[model samples]
Target chain A: MSVDTETVRRIAHLARIAVKEEALEPMTGELNTILGWVEQLGEVNTDGVEPMTSVVDAKLRWRQDEVTDGNYPERVTGSAPDGDDGFFTVPKVVE
Target chain B: MTEFTKLTMAEARDGLKAKDFTSVELTEAHVSAMEAARVLNCFVTETAERALMQAQKSDEKLQSGTGGPMEGLPLAIKDLFCTDGVQTTASSHILEGFVPRYESTVSSNLWRDGAVMLGKTNLDEFAMGSSNETSYFGNVINPYRRPGDETPLVPGGSSGGSSAAVAARLALGATGTDTGGSIRQPAAFTGIVGIKPTYGRCSRWGIVAFASSLDQAGPMTRTVQDAAIMLGSMAGYDPKDSTSVDRPVPDYEKALTGDVKGLKIGVPKEYRVDGMPSEIEALWQRGIDWLKDAGAEIVDISLPHTKYALPAYYIVAPAEASSNLARYDGVKYGLRHDGKDIVEMYEQTRAAGFGAEVQRRVMIGTYVLSAGYYDAYYLKAQKVRSLIAGDFKSVFEKVDAILTPTTPSAAFGAGEKSDDPLSMYLNDVFTVTGNLAGLPGISVPAGVDGQGLPLGLQVVGKPFDEEMVLRVADVIEKAAGPQAAPQEWWKA
Candidate 1:
């Protein structure tokens, strides 16, 4: 399936990456070119195949439901763009 | 001092042990070399001071006979790995100046083994380009230029800077990550040795996320022996990374027994694509003859799913990239572009921060995973991925390893293929299948093109069989003789 300008705009929104209105048309063309190229996979017969969830054969290891680490709020919030007292501060959401 | 910069990691290790030179002296030589080579745009941040400090400490340990395996060995790090307190940008504006409070597990492993940091090298933004052109810092110029031509060429990416640094002897070796031929392709273009160990062989804990299932860290170096030595330190079980396999790390250098006798090597016929230069074809034949002469039986094999590997990679990789990159929302860290509300702020920040290639990928990823198209694009691609992996599983039952050309062509001019995304993606044509299969693959510089640019031959081995891969690569490297070093044009 190919994408148009409107679909490109919608995808940019879903991805939370702002694409200006003028840029959408060219993006739509580029996406369509890639999508068109990948269309060759449709010829393959995948009727009984399973979607690959993991590449390696190892099973996920289970662990006890306990906190092994984490107490340094300062380290966790150290790189925050806007922080106050080791707390991440974001734009107000409540109206 | 220049002689110190010319020594390989193994040579440097021995010299340090014999008291031939101190770590500070070795690191100082590389620091000076790096300063001279800045015109190539290799490093994102050169940590000359930190390197000298670490080297001084290494000298103390060496004097006490307490140095680790990689003691006092200076190496360049791809910006993808978070070096504690050192800027780890992944060569993208989104992560500019984002230093980590803690170190990445792989890098921490290196430091624990006494490796000194020269600096962080640049890469394609978010590890997303074939050529290094997408790096926000600037493109890394290929140290090798065409004969009698002054036009610049790319080093290949997202491990391009690592390849350039090692190729130019600016560093003993450098760390590289391969999601879709990032390490191997660059190594091939730059005429060096690069290996991507089996998935889970190296911990992905600290390397910036780029298609988690496909990304694995390895070494880019001037020699196969050095690659083997470095991979030994880099690969191990890390409990921090949930996907990291709980297995023993082997002495990879020991695997370089340089014997390929009685080993059955498969040459996948599907790798020969349309428009492949005659020089590349000739190089492939030379590689086959070298292996055969080394007492190995060469068999023709068919990975029928090989053609589908690249296309399937585009889908799976971007889908994962979109999800992995979602964390950069301008709220937590790095660059922030303010907007009226939180959502708009995230939009503005990401749009402003990510490079063009990254934006296109995230959009494609979002579209494919959207409600109406998930099964058609994402699921189909994953199913095809299973087929690609299955092809390798079946082939490994017949042969110990597979030998193929590392890339379709030699290094091209910087802007040659960047305009067309599909054409750019085609560079990974021969190497992407290994990632899909989660196998160990290494690119050994085998021959040069007509233009005098180096090309590589790849050895792909079964799951967790990097030893066999290294063995075969060592045989090929021996057959090819030492690659002629790229001229030191940057050293005016």
Candidate 2:
């Protein structure tokens, strides 16, 4: 139930945010306060209550399973910051 | 020619049909109004030129006797919706300079219905904040104020701009997406009608994603009828969006006759929180009284899982938001911060792109979805989400609709909740339950709070039962009477 400074740092990294060391204390405190409030749910007796997933009980309707994406390679790649010859260029991975 | 600012969408349509006013005149008036209200920080981008062109086309169509229901009507779109060749930022630095190549389904639907686009309204960055303060552009002030008041009031958020623009009569109506009360809260704060339709009712394709499961685009307008007309135009099936309901969209306008005879209204015992202001409590009682006068049966119901909704939503929405926003890496369609290495580039880009609130949510989302914590957090939250929905189902067996305060308190000063994230989240407490359960909920201005700011009552309904929800709201809206036009809006 407690969010330590290390956990906060790791979460910040995963979220791609730059949280300075000094700010970690405040972040941890805030996270703990939030978690403390959320802990109120533990008091509710939900034993044997079936977990509901979606509001509508309907299952996902199936569409024709086929390869349909076409004619948009240039358009799709056009938004990328770095692209070359219809492909997205990422940093060198095997070096 | 009628003053375009005073004409509702319905009135405008009727005037156009009767040849009392031309589409061009209506469009020009709105454009001028928007220009005048620029100080409110309402619009992120304006489509004045394109709007004139569309209005001209509608004039031609009307001359040819081929005009449709919404022909020549000027509609403002939230900047969150992607409009081809138009800038669509979810009010985030990440999307700076990003213009969409494709139009979102909702915008396309509006266009197809002949609704002319006025422009994109501003919002909280990524629709993350309650007061609209987190928007990169700046805060949007409420157009409404007590007769002599000069102090600014929040228009509510993250649809603050849309509501403020509508209240200011900058646009006849605007599209707003609600994920955990964004649309409804703003609508309430500004004394307008906003509906979050049953989940899966509106197509999400092309609208910027924020907690995909809870996000729904709906209409924010001055009247219930305008909201109904706009909702009718926007709701439908879309194969492109996986979550869009394939079922037929009912005629929402036809269901707004203010008739709720024989309907059972459920007043949730849990919604009467301990600290709720007495005026809000009085408003709740008044809402029940009005519904009774309309011949609707009122019954006490319990959504025992209500307390769990805020926590469940905070966990679930952030978890989904984390995954949905992953596409915004600097290398994609938005702002990118280049770095010497790939990892450094991503870190810099995300850090530079997202604002403080957004980064905070992303961190919360990422933590809940992390490997070791997934089951304990995300999965557990999902289970609680189910129970929340179940609570609604159980209550629906006894009543046709549930009523509660749309917000704990009326529009607080813009900076009141900004510093406290938990207090800000509490703004959506009564609202998130509907999103979690995927039920249709509407906010109708009920009364004024202690500070004389407008308060709203939320009517939550069973899934796909938006008809009953709107019906109950119509009764409340009638009893509440038309909200007085803010005196400040008329100055100069």
iRMSD (Å), candidate 1? 0.7
* Regions of candidate 1 where Cα sits further than 4 Å from its true position: none
Q: Fraction of true contacts kept, per model?
A: 0.89, 0.50
Report the TM-score of the second chain of model 1 against its true counterpart.
Answer: 0.99
Worst 10 residues of 1 chain B by lDDT: B1-10
Q: Which residue pairs show collisions in model 1?
A: none
lDDT of 2 by residue, B295-409 (tens): 9999998888888899888888888899988888777677777767777677788888888888878888898789898867777778888788777888888998888889988
Q: Using TM-score as the measure, which candidate wins?
A: 1
Give fnat for candidate 1.
0.89
- Overall lDDT per candidate, in order of appearance: 0.93, 0.86
Query: Candidate 1 at residue B413, lDDT?
Result: 99
Clashes of 1: 0
Cα misplacement distance, residue B86 of candidate 2 (Å): 0.3
Error of 2 at B205 (Å): 0.8
